[model samples]
Target chain A: MTRVFAPLACLAMALFAAAPAVVANAPAEATMGLVQRIFYYHVPSAMLMFVSAVVCGTASAAYLFRRSAAADRLASAAGELVVVFGLIVLATGPLWARKAWGVWWDWDARLTSSLLLWLMFAAYLLVRRYGGPGSEKLAGAMALFGMANVPFVYVSVNYWRTLHPKTSVIMTLEPGMRSAFWFCVSAFALLYALLLALRLRLEERRAEAEALFLALDE
Target chain B: MRVAWAILRKDAAVEMRSREIVYTTVFFAASCVLVFAFALVREGRAMPDAAAAILWIAVAFSGTLGLGRTFERERYTDTLRALMLAPSDRPAVYVGKLLGMLVLLAIVEAALLPLIALFFAAPITASPLWLAALLAAGTLGFASVGTLFAAMLVRARSRDVLLPVLLYPITIPVIIAGVRGTAAILQPVPDEAMARFWAALLVFFDVVFVTLSLWTFEPLMTEQ
Candidate 1:
């Protein structure tokens, strides 16, 4: 894992550096003009946010049932990434909505669920931080519950009607925009992977230090 | 099944003896209504759909209080560990705890409903059956997750604060459904179909959450 980290970091940086050029050269959207370009960043972060949530929930389940320390660390790392990517999606979203929807925000299905998902993961991190001893299990339960909640939240809020574009918008993108969008997505995915690896390593080192301290006390 | 029944009976007996949780939780819920009434009322009239929102808000708030106290009793007596060690199924204990929570919240809502109707001029009798179904399903969904999280938090530090922090975001769907379903029924021209739709959604939420809670309760409650 350590050996691959440096090269992965370089590749992610390179992709990220090249992403802006690709996005700029992509054909201007027919209607929304330059503001539509936010889609290149916002949609990718949104996709990765959901992906991070699944990773955290799966790892948390593994930790709970298998009692694997490595799984617990991975869950912690993924949980934090969910919040990070969620922030990017959220911040970039309102900027686009301001131009497109004539309002900074709306309580539509996707917007509401995205905010709630972000809050749930934020709460997950909070429990792990302030819950003291035995908090890991509590945090794991939180992740599992948070993951299970996504659909209910979506369905309930969706009753109010949605203004967010259908996800099919991606599949139907113009040729130039399609390539640019996928380019941005791959860059974001690589960044997500790099961050998860680094965070997991940090958790591993912290656990080691704690164990060593306990041994010294004995 | 018998294990669940016995635990429920035990909780009932304890509450029957003291009536502490019931009396306090109901009063707290009523107070919540009054507070909302003051904020939402204008020219001696409540805001539109204020009754439904207030009713569910009171339920959620007092439900949090009730959940915290119920587990606080077990933690205070150090009996949760004993219950976990008993020769019975773990999910049964979870069901028992969840049933107890539902009962407590039911009493709170029973007292809450008429007060909200009178205060806000909601037509509570317009559709009694749908109202009850919505309340029942919503309460079940909320309490199912609440019971599990509250029980797990029993040993954690600062549990009082942590309970709501962890419980609210997950249970927001229940509150949304409850408030919207009740609002549909309370409207001048009631929309029975909309009410039914929200009620069905609440049932689905209850089914998913209850099953998830039952499955996870054993492992979460196991002290490592």
Candidate 2:
């Protein structure tokens, strides 16, 4: 784990450095013009946010049923990342909306569901933090519920008409922009992996130190 | 089934003795409506959709209060431990507790319905059966998740504050469906089709969350 950390960090940093150049080279969108550029960062961050949610939920279930410390730590790591990436999606979304939709925000299906999803995971982290002892189990239940809730939230909010672009837009993207989009996605994915690994290692160290202190006291 | 029945009976017997939770929850829900009325009603007329919104808000708020109190009783008596020790299924206990919550909230909503109609002029009785179905499915959805969280928080620190924080976000979909369905019924024309869609969504939500809660109940309630 220690040996691979430096290389992974370097690779992530390199990709992030190259991201701006690729995004700049992509052809500007026709109607929305330059403001559409936010999609490169916003969409990829949103994708990773959902990915982090799935990771957190799966790890939480493993921890609950198997009571594995490793899984619990992994869940904790993924839970925090969900919040981080969700912030990017939520923040950049409005900037683009403000330019394209003539409004800062709308209660459309995609936006509302993403906001609720973010809040649920935020609640997950809150439970784990302030719930005192035995909160891990409680937090695990929260993640599971949060996972099951995504579809319901989406469906209920989607009953009304939506103004946000459908996800199918990715399939029809022009050639240059398509490559740039995937480039940013891979960069974000690499960064997500690097951060998850770093957070997991930190949790492992904390657990080890706590054990050492307990042993010394004994 | 008998285990669940016994637990429900136990909760009912206790509530019947004092009527404490029922009374307080009803009053709390009423006050919530009154507060909203002050803000949304003017010149003796309520804002659009305010009735449906206030009704469900009152339900969610007072329901949280009731859930906390219900588990707090068990924690006070240390009977939760005894109940856990019993040779019965944990999910059955959850169902029993959930049934108790639904009953308490039902009474509150019953009282609230007339109050809302009088105050906001909502046509709550427009489609009686559809309204009832919406209320039932929405309440079940809310209570199903609430009961589990309340029970889990029984031993946690600052649970009173934490209960709403944890419950509201997860239960927002139920609230949305309930408010929307009730709003549809309260509309001048009473859009039964729209109400039916939200009702169906609420039922689906109930099925999913109730199943998930039942599955997680045993592990969550088990102390390490």
Candidate 3:
């Protein structure tokens, strides 16, 4: 597993290196200027956060239905990645918000939802860690709810009427800005894959060790 | 339906004999209201303006306390495992527990309402019937998911700590609707339409969560 992940990790690092260069070279927005560059990191991390949530939720559902150890491992791996990418979003968000909204934090719907979603997944990890014997099933249950909550959280902005940018605004970005955003998104996607693969391998090894211990007991 | 009633009856009998959960939950909620009043006084915010937020926070905290103790009742006798092994459907257990919690929370809220009105200077009786309906729907949603997680965490380490951590995030929508609805109803001039909208949101959440919890209860309860 390390052998496979080592090269992928190296590739992820290379992509991360290239991402900043692309962002720096891309034309800045007229109004926000240099600080607007944070969007490249912010939007992609948010994208990966959603993608990781779906992966975790799907794997959790699979675990519940099939009771497969592999699925549990995959869910656990993605659950951690959800936290990782969520931190990136949370961090980059405020940095951009300070520039754009002139406040470090706004109780805007999208921002609040992202923070809540992050906390929900964080609780999943806590349960898996501290819940003891039945933690896996408990965490799986949490993932299902977390998955179900994604849409409500997204729609809550519309329901409440908030200052956050709408999805349409993201789609309407200028051509150069859009390509730079996608490039950063692609880089983050590769980074997510590498991190998930590494984490899944760790889970697999831990399972094998536990199995071996039980076998020795026998 | 009979199975669920039987379970509810059993819980009721036990509660009548001990009166343990009711007394404690009511007192805790009272203290919560007092704390909110005192804290808000220090901040000099109008207590009536925060009435909705205070009421729901009390319910969330006190409801969590009741859920933990309710399941703790089963844990003491090892009845939870027996219930799991029984031939009857597991969702019945969900229903029974949910109903019992609904009653317990209602009692706590009954005590809480007057205290909130007195301390916060809010007119809770302005639209009593609508407020009651909103509270009912909100409690149903809270208890539906709360009972499921409380049971799931029965033997878990540090469940007392973990229950609120796990519960509040998922149930935010319920609390949000409850607070908003209550706020609208308690206003100087109540907006019937706003109250109805929040009520509908609570109902939708209750239906979705209750149905989902019912389907997932068995698989999660099973050791296999």
Candidate 4:
């Protein structure tokens, strides 16, 4: 089934992301100790990345099993969102990495893998465009296989030496830090949900345009 | 079995006699080396790993060229449709076609490896056996994806331009795994540390592409 329409998700996410406590009480450098404030966008962008991949994987599996056009649309929608989330990761990652790691860029495993993943998904987008009528099937297959890298990007931090910090929110966070972090988390998640919703709409328009062109040809 | 074998043998025989892929691929790879060499003359330290990356890049580019050429040959002059109509399960055709492509790529890679070593002045010796295997696996991974996609692109507007667009993006992970694996092995480190990571990646990727390509080929072929 088609997911909820884009406008609705965007509206809901906007409201949720803008709760007063998140924006007004955000731990500014003046108030909260340093390194405590980047949490606002960092975790949210990351959460969105995972959410996008999960959606991509779900739609891909649906398409493979059923081969329905609806499934293809969902997969495409999710794939498009992955690209969006990827851009978020890319923009926000370096900012945080530089602060956390003291360098603008490094060959840290997470950074490299994340960069590779962005390229991989970017490649996914290209593969779909390069594919012709029969490309949907190929795109579906790629979505599934490429999803493997999503987790690799996550766990890759642990695999090798990295400047990116280990996952520490759960293991050790003062309650105050946790509250601010959660605010950032909810805000970014809402932002992601909104963007994802809008992207899926664009995909529908593009798909509809393709169908129209094909019909006119006949 | 005989029917499939016939297709494989015919393909091999043609490649053997024409030597088109080998000649074109070797020339193309050498040209890449020379061009990149002149460009990176100041950065001589770019070395063999860089050479390896360039080597594989040329190999992938040339392999796609060959694949597109092969499909074009089938589309314009040969009997690809007739072969499909032949009494063979299509997966057999997939297997046979993939095998032929693999053999052709292997020949190109074998020739290119030492050249890469010589250019970079790095040893592509027996120590990097796993690295060599990783390169081979990565080639297969790209070939599998390219061969199937090339088949699809044959009917498109610009198959040659379109092939790399589709082929390389999907193959990025393979490139990462391949380059990383090769670099890891060539780093002169103990096998146990990074070996599992690269080997597992190569094996996992190889399995993924081979199986996915096989599964997708029938639908892609039937669509045309």
Candidate 5:
């Protein structure tokens, strides 16, 4: 019980402690000064969204290979979290896009692929819910396979000219931007770990609840 | 090879006797033809180039109709698993079924080609060689994926609606690439710089996907 809340409490504490340091070290914006903080939250959320999907895919493949009920449950956990965070990223991403690119979307390879990944995983979640009891095996295989689209999206920018800004991974941005970015990265990564751990506990509790009800009925 | 040939022959023979493939394919083709008529009614005469586009669509759609029907034949005969367990490699089953579909598509196209000429007044300048080459390349790509998809959806809840849902988006790129190559070879636009390159792309996509589907089909079918 306490295990679920511990990390989340720690995350809240960490973010509050780090926030002032990030603000003090932040650079003066030339224009639209306050709108830039979105960079911190949005970029890290998007990165963690990718991390969640890769985790889902890896867990799904493990589920397929071992046929373990534990692996299946873990895959489901990753899938549901990916959907929650992927949607958050999608929602906040447009805010960043609007500020940075002056439009909500530009059909940039990353944007298109991210939307596709969200939809595909959303479909997997839907299938898991709606599919009959025996459907897990088939649905799991499908989720694993459909992730091929992720790599395609990642590569599409390089393969073809696109409207989205190419990844600025070179790290030449000024120190203020760099500091905020790293702070946000650590903050969100902690938040993600906390949320995932909590979610997995809830899933286990739900399974226990189901078993209890079934026992009572029996 | 001989066993596959036998299966192909048997399916063809039944198709011939019942006139099933022809009737459905022609009916579907006729309805699509009506769509073309209504769409171009203001023009009053069908353009040859337009005729070519409509021609392939009729083939593709009617081919879907036949695929849905053929995949279930073993189910109706009470022998789907039995057929799979036959003393033949899984690829033989895939190839034989795909060939059956190709034959049906060819028949549908042949019926439509002349009708297209008669209905639209198209001069049919596309030489037989060009048309044959186009059909050969295009059909291989279509049949490979279409057969695998039909197999996938057979166990689904809504097989009919689901087949197209599962198949079309995957096949869209191939269809566009193919029709572009077909159009290029047929029209021979003199100023265009990359006609052959487009055709080459079609060949590449066809080889890649067909090989991919063939390798993947056995695991897909046999997987628990």
Candidate 6:
């Protein structure tokens, strides 16, 4: 536990330390003003959400084919991370939207797709928790489908061309803002790795306990 | 192909004898339209604008109900176990189920079209052939994914609820295409190009999901 917490604590500290630089050094957007600052946390959280979903999907594919406890555990952990970061995106998104778009919620393609992706994995976790005996395999299948939807979700913006900003907008940020963004991205990526490792350890311990229980029962 | 036909014939014969699923789904579709009419009438909204969206929502939900009951019948008869245990090609079984679902949903949609037309007083601007093509493509994509997920959910508890929760998120694109295509056909000035685009999207979704479902069905149904 200490081993896991020690590194996570350090990352948390670094994130806090970097938070000020992100706010102070990064130039505010000409349009959205102070609210644009949320972009740092919001974008990184969304990025990690996508990364976690991909990991979940790959690990799910692995579990589906091989039926390994390790793969299932990693997939399960990553699935939870998708929800975690997805919530951050979901929350920060509306706050930014309220400022930028003047509506707390818009049925824009990107926002709707993100919510759908989040719900898809939320359902995945539900199945794992309550689906009884073969839940792992069920959840694995869901993960694969969720992963498959990601590209479609990412592109739905182009397909519909609604209000949400396109990918090119991200590429056009000023250098300092761009670097600040990358720094936050790195910090959140580190956070995701730390959480995944800690979650996987918890899952392994639970598996060991269940195995011991079965042995004792026999 | 022969194996698929035999299963399809067997299910068709059984359905003909009982007509249980057909009646229930058709009734469900009607009820959905009625409920929507009542709800929307109270709100004094543009029912024509909502007509296409309402029709697809009814079909999607009722179709989900049919899929669950179809497998539940297999479970009651222990036929799922028998079929899984049998020495036969599994993808054939999937094809057979997919065919059965397609036929069933088509019937429900057939019943739904006139009801929507009457209730919303919306003119069907596109030709019948074009509308039928869009419906077929959309339902094909929907049932392909529905069949796979329903089969996977067969033994799980709360599968009735799980089916939709699991099914809807993945099938959103199909729903979007279906609604957009239907709207195009029902539009005041029908946009042939837009309708064709949505139809093409539906076809693309059907091809990808059907192929994936067939490849994965055997493994997913297997007890690991």
**Candidate 2 lDDT over residue span B120-220, tens digit each:** 99887789999999999999999999999999999899799888988999999999999999999999999988998999999999999999999999988
Residue-wise C-alpha lDDT for candidate 3, range B3-90, written one tens digit per residue: 8898999999999998999999999999999888888865545655589899999999999999999999999999999877778998
lDDT of 1: 0.94
- Tell me the deviation in Å of residue B168 in model 6: 1.2
Residue pairs clashing, model 4:
none
- Stretch of 10 with least lDDT, candidate 5 chain B: B188-197
Q: Individual DockQ of the candidates?
A: 0.90, 0.84, 0.73, 0.28, 0.17, 0.66
Worst 10 residues of 4 chain A by lDDT: A149-158
What does the lDDT come to for candidate 5? 0.68
Instruction: Score chain B of candidate 3 by TM-score.
Output: 0.96
Best by lDDT: 1
Model 6 TM-score (2 dp): 0.95
- Which residue pairs show backbone clashes in model 5? none
CAPRI level of candidate 2 = high
True contacts kept of each: 0.88, 0.78, 0.63, 0.24, 0.00, 0.51
Off by over 4 Å in 2: none
Q: In what order do the candidates fall by DockQ, top score first?
A: 1, 2, 3, 6, 4, 5
Report the error of model 5 at residue B17, Å.
3.2
Give the per-residue lDDT digits (tens) of candidate 4, residues B1-224: 66657877988787789887668867886787778777755655655467657766777877887788778878886578877788778778877777777877888787777776766655567466676677778888878877777776766665677677667756766676666666665654434456568667767777867886777666666652
First chain TM-score, candidate 3: 0.94
lDDT of each: 0.94, 0.93, 0.89, 0.69, 0.68, 0.86
Interface RMSDs of all predictions?
Answer: 0.5, 0.7, 1.1, 3.5, 4.1, 1.3
What is the alpha-carbon lDDT for the whole of candidate 6?
A: 0.86
TM-score of 3: 0.97
The DockQ of predicted model 2 stands at 0.84
Candidate 2 on A1-218: residue-level lDDT in tens?
88998998898899989888899899999899999989999999999999999999999999989889999999999999999999999999999999999999999999999999999999999998999999898889889899999999899889865889999999999999999999999999989998999999999999999999999999
DockQ of 3: 0.73
- Per-residue CA lDDT of candidate 5, range A65-128, in tens? 6666667777788778778878877888788778777998866667767776776677677657
Evaluated with DockQ, which candidate comes out highest? 1
